[model samples]
Target: MKIKKAFRRVGMFSLFVAAFLVTITSISNVSFADVRDWVDYEPMRITNTVTNTVTESKFRQSSLEKKELNYLEQKKMYISSDEIEGPKTLEEAANINQYPKSQVVATGYTAGVESTGKSPGHPEYGITYSGVQVKRDLYSTIAADLDVYPIGTILFIPDYGYGVVADKGSAITGNKIDLFFNTVEDVYAQWGKKELDVHLIELGDGTLTEKELKQLNETDSLQVFRQQITES
Candidate 1:
């Protein structure tokens, strides 16, 4: 009976040990499955988070760059306006002319007159000597001394706006400019002599050389002017 009892106790102890081992193995398998799931899922979550952060950062940078570019453009426009103010004296005018033709500025008196479209009775009449038609519209015409402002030269007159050197006259000499009007009444009424600022935007073809032509071709103003002419 003593031996049998000892045997039964030993058997019970072995069973308990086996049950504990099985429980440990099951726990290990569950832990490994959980690790595998984390390995499979966590990298994608991390990659998505990083991608969103980079995209947001790029968007912010682009917005800031646009604002900076706009500010620079506004600043350039302001500076250009200040630079175009007319020079006061003949010496000043000469000095400005020494610079690039595109940058020349002249301040002078302007007189307006009507075109009769006749002959020897009116020396300044009808079609321009340069072959350009005489029109009273904006920037369409102006009578200037060819020696001073050649035909095809573009001028920006304050209050009067833009005009081209399309015609010439004996009395329209030096810094004096003659603005053409369609009717004598309109000339007498609104086209009185006045001191004005003039900005020489571009020199005429007669004044530019081949080298100068190459240079003028690269200018933004000339390009824009040509484009305007083409469009018109």
Candidate 2:
């Protein structure tokens, strides 16, 4: 009778142990799932870096919302005005001359390259690094009004495509739109100062998203930093 009772107690203890282990495993899995969800839901930070010069074209015309009375015999009514010639220098760019309503905003940075060193191809000069050539994030510059446009702001320049303002440059100051060219030859190919009307759209704070963060790992800038790390 005592042996049978001992057997029953042993069986009960075994079942209790098994249940305890199952409960522990379930709790661990739930904890892991919570961590996984948090990681997946992480927010993205994007930052845009651009140059300090913006080009405004007076040639652009505003479209009429609605036109009344289309007279076929009258040859229609459209006001065609001459281009407003403006100054090209930074000192002259700040003046709200042509677009009277358009506000003047300062953005900094001229051109950026993969790094501070390295020469890019210039057709006339061969491979040179005298003038800046932006290989990455070329169009959008950091806005001077950090209050209005905080860091990590994304800017869209329809003329220059899309660019992120990751960092700021010293030379980029004031209302400027710096053009990025892969090579010096490309810059010269465009010829003397051309007039361009750029469309600027603000993207979010230009913070580095997880996807962009991955890109930095493989970029040349990372290699440079690695070399510095070893040297230091």
Best by lDDT: 1
- Write one digit per residue (lDDT tens) for candidate 2, span 80-157: 554344433321332323322222333222232432233345342212122212233322222233333344444443
Superposed model 2: Cα runs more than 4 Å off: 1-152, 191-197, 213-232
Show how many residue pairs clash in every candidate, following the order shown.
0, 34
Per-model TM-score versus the true fold: 0.38, 0.28
Per-residue lDDT, model 2, residue 59, is 26
Give one digit per residue, the lDDT tens place, for model 1 in 1-232: 9999999999999999989866754654434344455455432222356556422224433433343211223544355755776644322333433333232222222232324336544554455666555654435467777887887787765544456777677667777787755556555566566765667777776432333323434555334344332222
Worst 10 residues of 2 by lDDT: 58-67
Q: Note the residue pairs that clash in candidate 1.
A: none
lDDT of 1: 0.54
lDDT of all predictions:
0.54, 0.38
- Full-model lDDT, candidate 2: 0.38
Stretch of 10 with least lDDT, candidate 1: 103-112
